[model samples]
Target: MESSSDTFGKDDSADAKLQESRVVTEEEWLQKWETNNIGFHNEQGHPLLKKYMDIFLDGRSGLKIFFPLCGKTIEMKWLADMGHQVVGVEISESALKDFFTEQKLSFSEEPIPGIPGKLLKSTTGNISLYCCSIFDFTSTITGKFDAIWDRGSLVAVNPCDRERLVTIAEIYALLMLRATLRPPFYVPDSEVKRLFGKSCDITCLEKVDGLAERPKKWGLDYFWEVLYMLVLK
Candidate 1:
C-alpha cells in the first residue's frame, strides 16, 4: 500500500483537490510551539463543552472517539477518565513528544501502510498520528467513533478547506453513528444538509467563551463563537 504521505507532496495547499491534495508540508506548523506562537490553544476547558458534554454523552463509557488536530488536549485525559478510548491525529511530532512527556507515560510507535503514519500506543488506547494527511486515514480507520472532538482543527485551518472538512466530518458521522462538535468554526446548516441531506439531525449548536484574546497578545483578535453538532440519518 502506498503511504498517505506519499499521496500528497509536501507544500500542497490545504484547499487543493478538495480531498486528495490539501496535505501540506508545514515546518512552520510546529513553530507555534517552538516559538510559543499558539494563540488558539486554550489553557482551560471549553465552557460550552463542559455544560453540554453530559447532555450528549450521558456518562457514556468505552466509546471510541477521534480528536483531529488534537494538540496535547487535557480533554482527552478527561474522556479517558470516563472510560472512553480517545484517538487523536496530529502532524507535529514535537507537540506529540511534549504531550506524552507531560503525561509521564511511555508510548510505542509503529508505521501504518498506505499512509504515512506512526501509531502511538499508551495504556489507555492507541493514537494514530498520520505523517501524511487527514484524508488518507479517513479510509483506513474503521468502526465509527462515538464522538469526534475538535478544539481548534477547523478554525486553525484556512477557510478555503471548509468543504473538504465537511466531507470528512460527514464520513465520520456515517461510520461512527454520532457527531459531537467541531469547534472554533461555524459550519452552516445549509452546507451540512447539502452534504448529508436534510434528514440529518442537528444535536446542538452553542458558543463557548474563548480565552485566546485576553489583552490581545500575539496579534490575535479572539472572540468566542458558536460551533456545530450534527447527526446523520
Candidate 2:
C-alpha cells in the first residue's frame, strides 16, 4: 500500500479545492437519480470483494453484510449466494425500485417504526434493500450486520461530510461490536469507541490492495483508489 501522505502530496492543492465544496445531500443525490446520473453502479461484484470473500467469510454461513449507498449494485446477490444476508441502504427510492425491477425480484414494503422510510424485503435471502437515509438507520431496522462492505459510500461524500459519515460508520460498528469480524484500516478504533461508547476488539485487520476501479466519470486522481474492510469482534 502507498503512503497516504505520498498519495496526497502533489494533489494537496486540488484536494483542498475539492474539499471546500459542499457535500451532496439526499435531495441532491436524488436529483442525480432523476437525471439517471448513476455512473458509479457496477454491473458485477466488486473485484476486491470477489477476491477476499473467502478470507472474509472464512467458511462462515448465514452472516449478515451491510451495504451502504448500495446504488443498485449486484454485490448483494453475490453475498446472498454465499449463504449470507444483505442489508443495503440507499437514499433514492428511484434507484431502489430500479434495482428490484431490473432483478425481476418482487418485494413487499413495510414501514420502519420511528424512521421516516420503509423497508423492502425480497422473498429470497439473497437481498434486502432499505429505502432510507444512512444517518437514520438503527439496529432495529437493519438488525446487526456481521461485516460491512463499503465500496463507494465512504469516499462518495464530499470531504466536508466524510467525518460525519465516519461517525455514523462507528455507530454501525458498535452495533455489531460482538460480530465475528472487525474493520481493517481507514476507520480508526478511537472513532469507533466514541460512537459505540465502548472499546471493540478488531480481529483480522489487514490493508489489502487492488481496490481501484472506476467508470469514466471519475477523474484521473480517483482512477486508482484503496478500499478498507473490517470484521467486527
- In every candidate, how many clashes are there? 3, 7
Model 2 lDDT on a 0 to 1 scale? 0.61
RMSD after Cα superposition, model 1: 9.5
Candidate 2's C-alpha runs over 4 A off are: 1-17, 174-222, 231-233
* Full-model lDDT for every candidate: 0.56, 0.61
The candidate that wins on TM-score is: 2
Q: Which ten residues in a row have the lowest lDDT in candidate 2?
A: 177-186
Q: Which ranges of candidate 1 are over 4 A from the true structure?
A: 1-25, 126-132, 174-199, 209-215, 218-222
Top lDDT model: 2
Residue pairs with backbone overlap in model 2: 181-231, 181-232, 182-230, 182-231, 182-232, 183-230, 184-229
* Residue-wise C-alpha lDDT for candidate 1, range 1-233, written one tens digit per residue: 11111122233223223433344335667776678665556557555566667654756667777777777766666766677777777777766766778767677777866577676767445444344456566745555667777665654554466568667776665322222222323333333344445545554355444434452553434443544555566
